[model samples]
Target: MKSQCKSVVTIIVGAMFLFAGMGFCQEGSEGKGGSAEWTKVIDSKVSEKIGDKGLVNFEEGYIEAVGIGAPPEQFYGKPQARPMALRAAQVDAYRNLLETVQGVQIDSATTVKDFVVESDVINAKVSGLVKGAAVMNKTYLSDGTVEVTVRMPLSGLAKAVIPQAIADDKKTDMKEHKPVPFSKKPAPADEVYTGLVIDARGFQARPAISPKIFDENGAEVYGTLIVKREYAIQQGISGYARDLTSAQSNPRVTDNPITVKAISAEGVGKTDFKISNEDAKNIRAAKQNLTFLQKCRVMIVLD
Candidate 1:
C-alpha cells in the first residue's frame, strides 16, 4: 500500500509538469491573431514600452499592455497551476490596459480618464471595452510564471467616448462649419492633392483623438467642426507618423498630398497645430483637396 501511494503521487507530479510544458508551447502565439499583426506595424523609427502600464501606438492604431503573473499557492501539487497563472496574467493585462488607455489624449484639454471620472456611463463603457481587448500573445516561463499581451483599437475607444463630449447644440453647429472656398494658392496649384500633411517636427506636437489645425490668425482650419462625424468616429481626427516620408506614405494621406509647416503647437496637449496663414489659406482654397479633409484623410508628422 505504501508503494502504490508513492506511485500515485509521482504520476500527479509528472502530469503537472506536462501541463506546464503545454503552456510554454503557447508562447508568442497563444491568443487571437497572435503577435504577428502587432509586429507587422512596428518599425525601427517608432518606440515601444512595457511595464505597469502599456503603450499607445498611434501608428498602429491601438494601445497594448503586457501582464505578468505567477501560480497561486493553492495551485501547488496540481496540474491546474499554469492555467491559474494565465488567468491571473490576463487580469493583470486588463488592469494595465485600463491605465494606459486612461492616459490617452482625447484632445489638447482632456484625457480618457477625465471623461470617465465625469460620467459613470463613460466609465462603464470604457470598462466594457477594456474587457473586450484582444489578447495578442502569451508566454510561460520555465520558472512557472506567465505573461499576456492585450490590445485595444484606438478607433473603438474614440467611437465610444467622442459622442459623449459633443452636445446636440454643438452637433448642429458643426454641420454649418463647412470648408471655405478660395482661389489663390500659397505657392501654386502644383499638384492635384488628395490629402493634407502637416510637418510639425520641431513644434513638439502630440497625437490626440480630436486634434485640430488653425491658422496663425486663429481661424479653424481642421477639426471635428469640419469633419463628418461618422468618419471622425471611425478613422480618428487624424493620423500621426514619426517622419514626413511615413506620414506622406500613410494610407490616411494617399496620392499627391499638400504638405504644410506648423509654426507652433497650440493648446496644453500640443495636439492643435498653428500653421502659417498662407498655408491655411492654401489648404482651404485647394477645393479639390478639401474633400479629403472632410473624410479625415489627414496626417501629421511629429518628431
Candidate 2:
C-alpha cells in the first residue's frame, strides 16, 4: 500500500510539471506573434508617411516635403514630448519649402545690411504663405523620432502671393494697360490655332500676378486686365513647362495652338519679358481667335 501511494504522488507531480511547461511555451509563442504583428504595422505606417514620388502631381501644381523630429530633453519622460517634436518637425519642413521657393537672387553689389533687410522681408512673406500649407502625413518611429510631410499647392501659393505681387506692381510706375484689340477685320481664311505656346527656353521666367507679353518696341500686347481676375485667383498668372508634353499636361490645354518665343526678360524685382516680332505678330494674329486662348493656356518653356 505504501509503494502504491508513493507511485500515485510521483505521477501527480510529473503531470503538474508537464502542464506548466506547456503553458509557458504557449505564452512565449503568443508574445513573439504579437511583437511581429506590431513591427509589420509600424513598417506600413512608415511607408505611408514616405509617399511615392508621383505624389508631387506637377500637373496640379502640388509640391511635397518631408521632415523629422525627435524627443527633446525638456519633455523627457513626459507625454508632451511626441507632440512637441511633431510641431518642431512641421516648422522645419516649412522652412525647407521656403528656401525652395525663395530662390530669387539678390544683386551682388547690394550691401550686407541691405541684403539682411531684404531677406527679412522675404522671410516674412514666405512664412505667411507656408502657414496655410497642408499636413499630408505624420508617423512615430521606434527610435522615438517623429516624421512629417507637408504639401503646398501652386494654386494656393498663387492665391497667397498674387495679391502681394499686384500690390508690389502698383508701387512701381508701371501702369496697368489692356491688350490692343485686334483690328475688327475678317479673319484670314487659312488661320487656324488651338492655343498659345511661348518658347521661353534659354530665358529666365518667373511667376507673376500680371505676366505680360511685350512687343519689340516695349509695348504691352497682353496684360493683367486681359486675363480674368477670377482666373488669376484660381488658375494663376501662367503655367510653365519645359516641353510641349509638359505644357499639354496642364489643365489649360486647348485645340488651336499659337506658338511664340521669349527673346529677353527685364526687371529685377519682377519678371517682364519681350517676345520676338515674329512671335508678337503671331500673338496679334492670335487675338483674332482670342476665344480659344482666353484663359491664357499659355505655356512658357524654361531652361
Candidate 3:
C-alpha cells in the first residue's frame, strides 16, 4: 500500500511539471503570434483616458483641440492648468498603454522641441523614431505626433524579455537602456517687449517654444523675441507664413483672418496669422497682403 501511494505521488508531481511547461509554451506562442492583439492594449488605454476627460482628445498620436478657450489676456508661461492636466494624463495614459503592450522594444526617446505657443494656438512638437526588426530592415515613424518609438523583432531577447517583464509586474526592463533624448524645435511664446515694459502675453501662439521676455526691471513678459532663424515647416515645400500684426491689434477682428508681420527687428520668418478658409479666399481675392516666411515687419506692437 505504501509503495502504491509513493507511485501516485510521483505521477502527480510529473503532471504538475507537464502543465507548467505547457502554460509557459502557450504564453510564448501567444506573444509570438498575437502582435495585433497585443498592441490593442495600448490603444484601449489611450481611448479610456480621453473618454474620461472630455476636454482632451487624441487619435493615434494626434492631439485634437478639445478644451475651452482661455480667458482674454491670460498669461502664458510653461502651461496653464489645462495643459498640465493634459501632460499628466498623457503620461499616465502611456504608462498604462505600455503595460498592455507585450514585447515592445523602446529604442530611443527624445523631447520634441521647437514648439511655439503665442496666444492659444499650441504648435507643440512630438518626437521621431526608427525601428529595427530581425527580418525587415528598419521602419521610421515621425515623432511629430507621438512621443515614443518602438521596435519589435521577431526573435530575440527583447521579445522574451517583454513578456517576462510584463507578466512579472508590468514593468519595463529597458529603463536603463533607453535611447538619447530628442530635442524639439523651440516654439513661440506669448511675451512681447515694448523696450520699456515686457508684456506677459501677446496672444496665444505656441507657448512651448515661446520664451519669457524680461524688462530691465526684471519683470517677466509673456511675449516672444523677434529672433532671426531658419524656419522650416514639416514638409520642406511652400514656406509660407501669415503675419499676426493686424490680428493681434484686434483680437476680435475675425474668427479667422490671414494677417502677416515681422515680430522681430532682425528680419526672420514672420508669424502666420491664420483665419478661416472662407475669409482666406476673400482676403486673397481682395488682394490682401499675405505674409510669407521671409516677409519682415509690416506691423508689430512691442508694448
**Greater-TM-score candidate between 1 and 2:** 1
> How well is each residue in 1-303 modelled by candidate 1, as lDDT tens digits?
345333333543343334332332245556652234445444533323433457777766778877777888888658988777877676666667777787888878888888877766777677767766777778777778888777888778888777765443155434443434544444355767878898988875777877788777666788766677778777777888888988888878887788998999989988888888888877877556567887889998877
Cα-based TM-score, every candidate: 0.77, 0.59, 0.15
Runs of candidate 2 with Cα error greater than 4 angstroms are 1-59, 63-66, 74-83, 94-132, 139-144, 163-181, 204-210, 248-251, 269-271, 291-294
Q: Write the per-residue lDDT of candidate 3 for residues 1-303, one digit (tens) a residue.
A: 345333333543343333321211221132221123324533332211223211111112212111112212343332353333323333332332222221121111101111111111111111111111111111111221111112222122222222222232213322422222212323223221111111112443211112222222222111111111222112111111122343234322223333322232210222122223333222223211122211211222221
Q: Pick out the ten consecutive residues of candidate 3 with the lowest summed lDDT.
A: 122-131
- The CA lDDT of each predicted structure is 0.71, 0.50, 0.22
lDDT of 2 at 291: 55
TM-score of predicted model 2?
A: 0.59
User: Would you give me the overall lDDT of model 2?
Assistant: 0.50
Predicted model with the maximum TM-score: 1
On lDDT, the stronger of 2 and 3 is: 2
- Per lDDT, the best of the predicted structures is 1
lDDT of 1: 0.71
Q: Order the candidates by lDDT, highest first — what do you get?
A: 1, 2, 3
> In candidate 2, how many Å is residue 121 off?
16
